[model samples]
Target: MTLDTKKNAFIELGKFLSQFSEKDTIKKKDIVENDLGPLNPTLSQVFFEEFQNLIHLSQSHNGWYTPEQVYFSVQSWSEALTEDNLNQWVGAYDLSAVQPKNIALILAGNIPLVGFHDFLSVLIAGHNVLVKTSSNDQHLLPFLSKCIIAIEPKFANKITFVEGKLENFDAVIATGSNNSARYFDYYFKDKPSIIRKNRNSIAVLNGQETTEQLAALGEDIFRYFGLGCRNVSKIFVPKGYSFVPFFEAIFKYQDVIHYEKYANNYDYNKAVFLMSNFKLLDNGFLTLKEDASYGSPISSVFYEFYENLPDLQTRLQSEGEQIQCIVSNNLVENSIPFGQTQQPKLGDYADNVDTIRFLITIK
Candidate 1:
């Protein structure tokens, strides 16, 4: 797959994925399982846009280049994955000089179709993928694999779903919580793996965000209840900041976040807050409170306020390793949210891992 060739293929893939726009069958399982209950027209648009933005970002952004030049070698790998130069780049690596002949991909299910990039990396690199889909995301992984097969049927042979055995894999790429990483480290000893554990993501706020920016940032925080790695669980605000707009922007989602399980979490947290004498700004549905933990609260969202930049920086620095992507409104050293937080750029890859590089590395 030359760059041009791969680009052309993605163009076609994008075209085909768009056909599902009006199809009711895409959310068939969500409705039947009561996970999504009744699908409203407004919410339907939100769900469809998720696929549209992710697919578009993957194609247009070369998987979204890291402008910070943080992943230099990885960036080159992403460039290779594009439809433009894949053919010329394939087998460009001196695999005989390396040790691994097969690739093991330990996929995560936190978000929909999170492992597709790794799958693409393995197949494009001419290696085999031992994919373990997250239980929560079992649905989207195969669907993506089928999409690739539709594009190049021969690729169907190289990708595999590994259930129990992992030793056969030459190298491993795993994603999980910090606790799970401990288990993975204990289980897969000395196999040459990239194991990613739990990390909190935050947004750096200079307190200059526009109304739309504040609303969109709310989407990132409230979307999926901040269950994602990229979810903004905390904010760095200047002295005397008001959270009024933030509350309003995010309040629209209160009705939709009505799963009994989720609601239980919220109510439980609310009770605890009240019991502990914590103040809550309740505007009918959602509650905002100051919290220390990065994980999302059950019933509402939490953030710790900072009056000074130095103090916030020191705190964040102490917990830097646990942090993931940072969303800012063009603030210094952060990722900016465009529309929704869960919605990523076309070329964005998780943990700054280059899906294209991982694809071609083992080859």
Candidate 2:
């Protein structure tokens, strides 16, 4: 299939996804266009209904995949998969003379549809993809693949989901923890690959942040229950920084404690911290611990006191590999704005590795 054909297919898939969100699922009557023309109405309705069922069924398949979280993910992708966004993202690459290769994708299931960007990247670059879905997030992407195939049957030849061991792929893109990344490194050593290890996002605070910015920062923390690499797992504060304003700003998210899994984590992590005599600041739902680590457990955020901005910037730059995003009021260079980490654009490549540039260059 041509690049335009693949782009239009994904655009249609995005339109189909646009119908569902946390608030409601409403099907539009606009006929989806592919290279061949408009999709059949009956076929469109079938895919729409199937997606609705998948949204509810996702929670049963994985407790962490609550409908609201799933909907948030769906809505984010829907907003991203537009014509302008696609053109802007891919326009930089010269894909005209590319030779199609079989690209393997080993996805992480930390959040809903976490690996969809890699999937989209492979196809948009005119390559076939062999996907191994993480057991924690098995259903959503395959169903979306079906929608893409329905929109453009040629995609059927370009996409494959391996149920057993992965084989017959020229290169690989895998996301996993630090331990698993070691295994991927050893196994895929001979092949050209991108092996991603665990990373965490953090925020830097000078103690002058507004309630609005802090509250928005709460979205960065609590969204997806803090499972995504983009989630702000830690924050940097000045030596005498106060937690009162931060706590008050994030209090609106207290409802998260109502979820049994998160509450269990809160109770368990809090007990562990107390047993070790670690001082913690608690607000009934979330906890703040003065730990130097970047990766924090669920329901808690690690914080460290910084001596100065220059030193902190140098420190963070030195530890860049372990960090995904730095959320600040532009205090640090190239830091993402508060609350925008989770809403990454199409070009926001994970690990700052250019996936498209990697894909098109593969021999």
Candidate 3:
């Protein structure tokens, strides 16, 4: 596809999502129903158009990719087939380059539709996919594939969803936690693969961040109610940081505190914090605790302070491989950061993975 055609497809997709804006966004009941329903409405007219955008637009990135980047992915898809970037599209190869007969994807279940990109890539790249979706998020995918078949029915057979392994598949791309990474490495050692293990995303907040910056940070921290690995579960703040200003700026999400699962996590963590005598600044919903670890909280997360950039850099260096990207004012020459450690732009993935392009190279 020409770049313009690809871009136009995404614009059309975004336009389809505009309908959601007309509905009652602030209604708690509406939010719940939408998140549980039309949120994944594969056959709905709204979703049909957006799915095309999602497939063509492509949104997986450093963290949860912004909507804009998804659009660009489609526009850039065909470019990967050319020679200049072919080496990258095919990945590093030795001996005779080859294509796999099948590809297996063990998707992570933390966020809404986490494995969708891998599925799209595998299908578009011309390989059969053996998908074992995380049970926690099992509802939306097959519906999505079904919708695609309704659009471009020819693709219906290329993507398959199942609960077990396909021994015939020649390769694998798995997403799992750190512990599972070790298992995947040992289990799939002989097959060529890209196994995504656990990585904690971080936010580096300089003292100069604005109120708007803090508010946006809330989006990064709680988009999936802090369930996603990309959610900024931990943050690095400058010394003498004030939690009040930050909480005040982010208090807009207090309604999320009422979410049953989110509330349960907050209550559980708050009790633990009280017993352990950890300092907390609760605005009735979220809390900020220093010296905390990743995956430690729900409505609330963790943060630590640094004396200077050098000290923070030293600490970050030790955790580099385990980290996806450091969102800060200055992340080295080529490093990227969105407005005050919030959203990541297109192409800021861990290990710099261009996943959609990688999928197309299966052949």
Top-TM-score structure, candidate number:
2
320-359: candidate 1 lDDT, tens digit per residue: 6777777776654455663445545444656666555554
Clashes of each: 26, 0, 2
Residue 325 CA displacement from its true place in model 1, Å: 1.6
**Candidate 3 backbone clash number:** 2
The estimated TM-scores of all candidates read 0.72, 0.97, 0.72
| Worst 10-residue lDDT window, candidate 2 | 31-40
- Per-residue alpha-carbon lDDT of model 3 for 199-303, expressed as tens digits? 766788776777887787777777767666666778888889877777888878788876666788889989999899988777888877876475556777778
Residue 248 of model 3, lDDT score? 80
* Model 3 poorest ten-residue lDDT run: 24-33
Q: Supply candidate 1's per-residue lDDT for 233.
A: 69
Model 2 per-residue lDDT at 139:
96
For candidate 2, the lDDT comes to 0.92
Ranking by lDDT: 2, 3, 1
lDDT per residue (tens digit) for residues 237-303 in model 2: 9999999999999999999999999999999999999999999999999999999899999999999
**C-alpha lDDT (0 to 100) for residue 58 of candidate 2:** 93
Among these predictions, the greatest lDDT belongs to 2
